[model samples]
Target chain A: MMDRMAVTTTTRVAELHELLARHETSPAAGNVPVHPELVELFPRGLRTGAVYSLHGSMSAALALLAGPSAAGSWCAVVGVPDLGIEAAADWGVWLDRIALIPRVPAGEWTSVVAALVEVSALVVAAPPEHISPGEVSRLLARLRTSGSTLVVLGNWPRAVATLTGQVTRWDGLYDGHGHLRGGSLRLEVTERQRTRYADLELPVRP
Target chain B: MISAAPIRVLLLWCPGWPVLAARLVQGIAADRALALTDRGVVVACSPAAQAEGVAVGLRVRQAQHRCPDLVVLPHDVAAETRAFEPVLRAIEEKIPDVHVVRPGLAAVKARGAGRFYGSEEAAAHALLTHLQRFTADELRLPVDLRMAVADGLFTAEHAAYSSSARQPLVVVPTGRSRDFLAGLPVSVACDRRLANLLQRMGIRTLGDLAKLPRAQVNSRFGAPGLRAHQLASGEDSPILRPRVVPPELGLHVAFDPPAAQIEQIVLRCEPAAEGFVQLLTRSALICTEIRVTVQLEPDALFERLWRHPWQFGKTEVLDRIRWQLEDLATEAVTTDDETLGASVLSVQVLPESVDNAEHHAQGLWGDRPDEKVEHALTTLQHRLGHESVLTSTVAGGRLLHERRVLRPWGDALPTLRERRLEQPWPGTVPGPSPATVFSSASQVQVLSADGAPITVDERGTVNERPTWLRTHEGQRRIEQWAGPWPIRQRWWRKVKQLNRFQLVDNHLTAWLLLSDGAVWFTEARYD
Candidate 1:
């Protein structure tokens, strides 16, 4: 049942580690906490073709749009019905990024992104219906390896999987921000390659 | 002469019971009302045949003896309050500054009303119309409603009680309220006991009360009488208070033709829910409970409660909603039962909060599995209703039957015991498990017959050593077999639990095998 899937996913991580080591990502060879091979995820703060938990994915996109400015961009947002965007705005990201979209039915939503895709680096799209595994596989295979990021949000997906080399799963909070609030994320990455390394949990900047 | 905005007053009484001048006054509906006897009616305007010098308060027989044409109206308290609503509404509309004196009286700042709504006469006409409409709408009043819009609440109130011939509306010129009361009788005010006491003191007119030393009247009449005096003299100070209203918010979507299909309904509602989320976003609140209400037919409405919360996004919301619609669509519909119709009438989001953050407070952020597990369970429940699906584990007993159970989650399982998984795990069941599990639905076929293995009757009877026979799709033979292990529970109960087991499926897809010494059963499958 579901137990098999969990076992399969766990086994895949070991397979991914083998692939990373094959790619020359050696633990003793690299100085940083993350394997040298996966450091490529943030090349100048651009989220290069990686899977992210919705909010974490959004943070990466916000990091890109805000540039080097300590105080990020301001926004006038709309249409992000289910997302509590204020959670991000508090981290010093300005609100000019917000815009309200009128009602968009679930079935007719993918095409709605054509206009938003060009201007906004990160357009939070709540797909109208469940995206099939075939659809997800199709989307992953079609990626041109460009620098753009898309964050798909939900209450919880029954299971998550994609056909990609790097599988960066979110394990949760990073230490030392504050007692009650303030901290970043601890993302455990499984780089599926044949050469060097994979399967490691590391805290990146918030 | 008055130079500033004139004061406005409205007096109204709904209805009570009748006893005295006080009772009649108490029973009046308009901001003000008067209890008039046949004799009082006669004294005011009736022909000499009706009046014949009959004074107020005389019995009907005495009035009839005094004047044969006197007309009488039995007291009506509720009718009076109903009658007053229109006048209250009218005066409220024309001169917002008015104060209600009681069931029968009202007053307005005359100078402003006269200038704005056009002369005092026009304003009074407007007030009368407003009251008349109220009477028609609320009281079903048959009587032609009447009222006087004057300089003071007292004058307007008296005017309301007066016959149409007596001028229902009169303008007491600026600074004239006091002057207008000069000839009025002392008993016209509500304090009849005080009025009678004053009358015993030889003061029968308003002028007589005003004529008494202010100090003497203050000492003799007490505060109620003093208030009554102030009212009679048109000098009462009004203290206005506003009414409190309840706080409730709802978001509704109306489609052009109404949708019956769940997908179509979800399409319209996701955005509406988004809109609902947006409206309440500024309030620093989150909802864990939502009741889905659907109006299928013009006459039929269906509603169910969704008690679940998300740690993050709206995915769980959309999934459960869609799955619920799917489950509903699969129902065994009858001729009378309407399939979901077209046009989703509305989706209402109930406000529930897991966090009571102030407007500026931040929600607790961290990786939380409970919110995650809850989201999954809710999605399953919405797609399955309360009965069909379950997460079953063997517990709470020593016997095989008693050892089986279903624990609750956000999904519908039998019970919920709040357990913490933050610490090192101990008692959880081992994994690498079966894919599909069952509880009460599928029955087992036993194959224990005479010369061979026991076979189950299609009706489930078995006298021989039973062999497991379960049917779903097709009959596939047992590939490999595992256990006849025993489970016993509920030693406290007279009927203890005794469950025997075996795993029989050729492909290594595990299926739970069992028998109660007497009968065998199939419990689950590894999908």
Candidate 2:
């Protein structure tokens, strides 16, 4: 029953997006750009005032934030205390403009995220373990009012889209003797609202 | 030619100030015999104590003998100075340009204030009335406050002291300062040693000192005598200059019911914070350092000085208030019953240091994005407690984790990192740096092709090449690998050593592996 409700809500959200798309302006004002390789997954890139859920890979979730961050938008990582700072920097996210709030007390999680959305262009957070659907909807409302995007690292009940990636192949190795370099990831993007799906192979840099 | 006479100055002298300040802090009655003792000797004594035969130079035991009921308190100069700050601030409230001659006394130019208040006499009365009300109401003590106006600070101070208890204020006419000083003893012009010498030289009164030839006085008593003789002749020294008072830029809010909730307190202070920022903005100034003082129930106070790399705005001010309140709340909840674990009575924000905002304006293109980012970060910090939001900067350290330091937003970035980054660090991990460093290293098993565990030798060399890696996540094939970089740290003491290796699995994910001769662990990942 919950799944069905989520699906209907997703469809309603998609219809809302389609209506918005018809009135959308040029790329400069509509959505933030992403890496070219992942363009097939998000053809028009990540939209402002939207939330995306990324599963199975922390690196990919951080990658989604790097593009907007590099474009001079301030980004914050909330509730991920163990996130690797070096990895975020390696992904081309500007470290100076990035704030890390590794922990938010259970009661203050909503307030903290709302505050971050007001000032930050992008907020990547790991939803707290026991957040209710109502809280998610309220946070989404806040994000919309502030015109900031939220990238959730785990399952979000009504996320606009969910992007999941699995490692597909390893490169830069010679008979298990050479230094470990980089690899490729098979990314599967599911747009919840439109019930659309896309797949692509994206390069992963170390 | 008469050198321009010292501008008329008013001195507010609190007699036996050290004792008064001590009594003010202790809440002791003025009628009680109290003496502030320094090094076991009385430095200052109250009037009631003085009448009981307690004098400044008397030993504590002797003073106790003279007045059995005398309260002997140790002289705390710092406490006296701290207690006197509010008194100076109070005087400054009415008279703008008051300068502290010392903790006990303050001087201000009376000429301008006199004209503004209609007359010098009226001005003195107004000042005395204000101080009297302040002492009786704010300090809740009956102190003998005296004020006097004259040509020079020294004479003015003396006049205040010499004035009878019935009429505490003495305002000498402009040209009568010379006449007022004529009959005063020479001890008023110089220290004890010089006063003794002047008495021996027959200069008993200031008039007698003024009678000596200037060059003779300079030669006999040196510079001190010349300065004294000039002062005795009613010539003003160059010391009394009116101080330039900085604008008072502090806003305060009182909670009617006294609030314990941090959010409620912050909300109440929001309007005042906005007004404060707007006030500074209108003056083209910005505050770099602010003092947030929280008054708790029953007189407990919590105050902290916060500094910012850039000028603070309303958001930053609110963040500081919330941070301070949160800290106070936590302290109250965790501490003993003796701590003041009560609601906040009031909050005061005082801008300690300010700079011209024009100097900090963004360049021609206007850095709007940076401003927005700062505002957002500051707002976030206010919402999630100050410690939750942080920016990482490099610092001096031998280890990777130690080298990276996190500072709260709006704080000055650590400068130690830049200098530390230049130093040669042997045994440091070679980069391309790891994409993600684990907060703590996780144990992993590196197995040979036959599934036997690979171990490092005493010389930091691996016994066999690992073909498989087993972690909490599960096992995977090792596709590429490098290094057994050896690092023996603190060899002289516990003699701990480690061998590090870079490993890549079939999925191309890289891990930094470490072995302490017995076991292997994954310390970081290159995602």
DockQ of each: 0.02, 0.16
Q: Which ten residues in a row have the lowest lDDT in candidate 1 chain B?
A: B359-368
Interface RMSD of each: 24.4, 14.1
Question: Alpha carbon lDDT of residue A39, candidate 1?
Answer: 46
Clashes of each: 100, 2
Where does candidate 1 stray beyond 4 Å?
Answer: A1-206, B1-108, B122-149, B182-205, B219-222, B238-252, B261-294, B298-527
The TM-score obtained by model 1 is 0.30
Docking class of 2: incorrect
Residue-by-residue lDDT tens digits, candidate 1, A69-172: 12221121113332222223323333333322323545434333333332233444545456566555444433213223344443223212121222243222
lDDT tens digits by residue: candidate 2, B1-527: 23647778888988778888988789888799999888999989998998999999999999999999999888998899888887888898888867888888899889889999999999999999999999889887777888999987877877888887689999888877777888999998988999998888787999888877999999988988888887887777536654434556888999889877777788999999999998776566668899999998888889999988777888789978877877776677645432336888999999988976545453212322344566667666656557767887555544555555677877766665563767877766654555466666678999999999998778766677789999989999987787677766642124378777787787667787877777877777765
- Cα lDDT listed for each candidate: 0.42, 0.76
Locate the minimum summed-lDDT window of 10 residues in model 2 chain B.
Answer: B362-371
Best by TM-score: 2
- Give the top-scoring candidate (DockQ): 2
Q: Per-residue alpha-carbon lDDT of model 2 for A1-206, expressed as tens digits?
A: 33453455446545655654574433325576665555666788788788888877666766777877777767888887667665566677777778889888887788788888877778889888888888878888888878678888888887878877666655454543444445666667777445444333333342
